[model samples]
Target: MARKLPSRTTSDDTKSARTRERILDSTAAVLSRKGYSETRLTDVAEEAELQSPAIYYYFKSREELIEEVMWAGIAHMREHVEGVLAALPPETSAMDRILAAAEAHLRFSLSVSSYTTAAIRNSGQMPERIRERHEAERAKYGRVWRKLFKDAADDGELRDGVDLLTVRMLVIGSLNWAAEWWTPRTSKIDNVVEQARQLISNGIAK
Candidate 1:
């Protein structure tokens, strides 16, 4: 007779998922501050308030644990972008969508500061799967800029001879880099939003 298999249920799966999430969250905190090279399983375990051996139950090694954390962070960023895309009104112009998307990106990045910081700093040490996931999310988000530029061009909103790709690079590069230095108390989000809107709307022409 074949050996009996363990039964999987909604409750069991949910519990397991929660535990995995707890480990990942703790791992992100450790990796974000100390980075992959300096981080250790003990650090993650301590941060999570779990025994070092407990970590092995979810991940085989520190590398795997870090990979999961990076994966979760990127997944979160993608979800934020997708949520913004979904919330947009169907009749809204692409330019409006772009502005809204920028605000959303800024809010999410700032709100999840530690996770974003960890993702950016430890991205190089992440596994191939994490890298691929990050690229996919980026490509999906890039479509928003492309669509906005195409619509703007169609509506004659852009200045003569303005390159759409250049505009995207300038705008997104600025927004992403803001996470590096923006302070919640001093550089408030509303101010950042307005400044970004002004920068993009003012056009990049010399």
Candidate 2:
């Protein structure tokens, strides 16, 4: 005879979800502080105020937990970026709007250091489903960049013969890599943001 499976009541499911979120949040903190190379499951458990074994009840392994945390971070980033882009004035110059978007992205990334770091470093290790989710959001971000670059080129803002793809990757890659060493005491984000804007504008300015 086949065995009967247990059912989850509504309240139990809600409580379970809350616990899982707490663990994932704690894991993000640990990953941010220690990075993927040095982070441990026990450290995460301690951060979550749970026994190490209890963690397995939610996540089957360290890899799985990391994946979950990475996805969460990516989702948060996507929402913030999409929201900012959506709020831009229709008549804003593409170059100026792009700079504003860069500033917003850097601000959000630096403010949520752990999540940003986790999302960037663990991106390659994400499961296919998680990867697709992130890719979809990233594609939306790409559209904004494409529009900015194309408009700038068309408007005689960017230098003739400039490769838009190369420019886009360099500008965005540098900004995304900022989460690695950004610190509350010494990192001047606004200045860095302006510098990044100037760098891109000067490099490709017509």
Strongest candidate by lDDT: 2
**Candidate 2 residue pairs in backbone clash:** none
lDDT of 2 at 38: 76
Off by over 4 Å in 1: 1-12, 124-130, 204-206
Q: TM-score of predicted model 2?
A: 0.80
Which runs in model 2 stand beyond 4 Å of their true positions? 1-14, 124-140
**Tens digit of lDDT per residue, candidate 1, span 1-206?**
99977777877999888888788888878887788789988898898888999888888877667765666665677678778878888987666767777787778777764676677667667656547766665576678668867887787667788888987888877887776677777777889989887777777422
For each of the candidates, the C-alpha root-mean-square deviation to the true structure, in angstroms, is: 4.7, 6.1
lDDT of 2 by residue, 127-196 (tens): 5754665676567667877887888888778788889899888888887888776777765877877887
What TM-score goes with each of the models? 0.79, 0.80
Backbone clash count for every predicted candidate, in the order shown: 0, 0
